[model samples]
Target: MKTRTWAPYALIAPTLVLMAVFLVYPIASVGWFSLRHHTVTQPWKNGFIGFENFRRMLFEDQLFWQSLVFSAKWVVVEVGLQLVLGLVLALIVNETFVGRGLARSLVFSPWAVSGVLTTGIWILLYNPSTGIFQQLAQWGIGDAGTSVLGNPETVFPATVVTELWRGVPFFAILLLADLQSIPKDLYEAASVDGAGRWRTFVSITLPHLRDAIVLSTLLRAVWEFNNVDLIYTLTGGGPANQTTTLPLYVARKAVDSHDFGYGSALTMAGFVILLFFSILYLRLSKFGSRA
Candidate 1:
């Protein structure tokens, strides 16, 4: 009995050790640093003041709240769009048709694209002079203004669209899996009762997909909240603070300003907010133990 229990631990020991070194240790260090004030002006000489960094960030920094709000809105739109578009694609792919396998591969091909590549491609498309949109703008149909990502009016929504291009593919694939997992017999039974496609989807398909949908939504929300790469590469959160989300703000504080402690405090705050969103998703999902 002891050997059996120990065997499982032995197999996962490396993974646990890696998590401790890479994940847990860094998180704990960030917590420790966030409580102190470390500035480049003082360099090595530093003094600790508990909660001061957090207090300053929470109350005094207006950008913090703005970033939080912008990021919240971004997630709301991104997750919603992902769900709608992904579900549509999954439903289409689930149909019994020839060449569906190839069709699915084509649809999900974008998921293999790197985040950096996606941002870069979108930036090119947003370029004023030679971009696809710019050409369309000349014809009076598309946005012909300055850099789409650089426009205060357009930046947030524009970036969200770019993000969607990458995100929807993954969402579609996951939803497709969930859609395939649903048994065909359920639909047959529903049809026998004179139920239509919409009724069967509502009664049978959606119930089976609830768990996958919850998992995908929560994962996407968390990752999107932490997304610095896409925003940083796309517009650098300009033409003003319009596109600046929490991650970008934290990056500016840490890397650009070289205020480690303040940035760490910002990171802590972000972690707390994301954690709350996660807990709320869990509560809403009715996720019980996998019995």
Candidate 2:
């Protein structure tokens, strides 16, 4: 009885310690740093300054607001498009057909690729002088020497397309897994009761996928909001910072400027905004209530 009581705690102790060391400690440190003057380059000015960083970030920083707006736009467009395309892709692969295994593998291969590699491949493809566009131009399809990344007018869409290549696979794989778990009996019953494809999908499939869609979208939104690797390497938040998200801005502040205090404040702001939205979304969507 005594061992049983302590066994659970003992089993979880290592995980609890790891979480404290990695997650809790870092979050606490960031919170503490957010309220201080902790710039690495200016050690002479290092001291506690309550809410000064937040004050400057919330009211005085134009880049912060700009990055926040871009982050919102980026998340909305990326997640919305990925969800739709992923659902379609998942549905296609879920159906019984010749080469289904090969098709599913090919569809999911992009998600297996690392962000750095994906960015590298896209960069090579986007090269103005020696890329797909140049090839098309040589074939008399479009103009030559088209710099998609360099052009402010096209950079946003280019980045979106590039990210969609990698992101859509994630949603597809996740949704596909959930889709397979759906009982076949429901579909058979719906079909026998005179339900057509679209009607059956609307009545049975969508509802069954509700929790997965909500959870996946929320997780992907949080991830995309924090995503800096691909965007950093691909665009470096360039074309006049048009592609810069909030996380990218924070990276610039903390890394480029060594303004740890300000960066911490920005991180805190992101955390609050993300938490609020996540809660609101789960509540509004009534997540997990269906299944």
Error of 2 at 204 (Å): 1.5
| Candidate 1 local lDDT, 191-222, one digit each (tens) | 99999888888999889988888888988888
TM-score against native, each model? 0.90, 0.93
Residues forming the 10-long window of minimal summed lDDT in candidate 1: 282-291
| Tens digits of lDDT, candidate 2, 189-241 | 98899899999899989998998898889889989998999898899999898
**Which residue pairs clash in candidate 1?**
none
Off by over 4 Å in 1: 1-5, 40-45, 137-143, 280-288
Question: How big is the positional error of residue 124 in model 1, measured in Å on the Cα after superposition?
Answer: 1.8
What does candidate 1 score on TM? 0.90
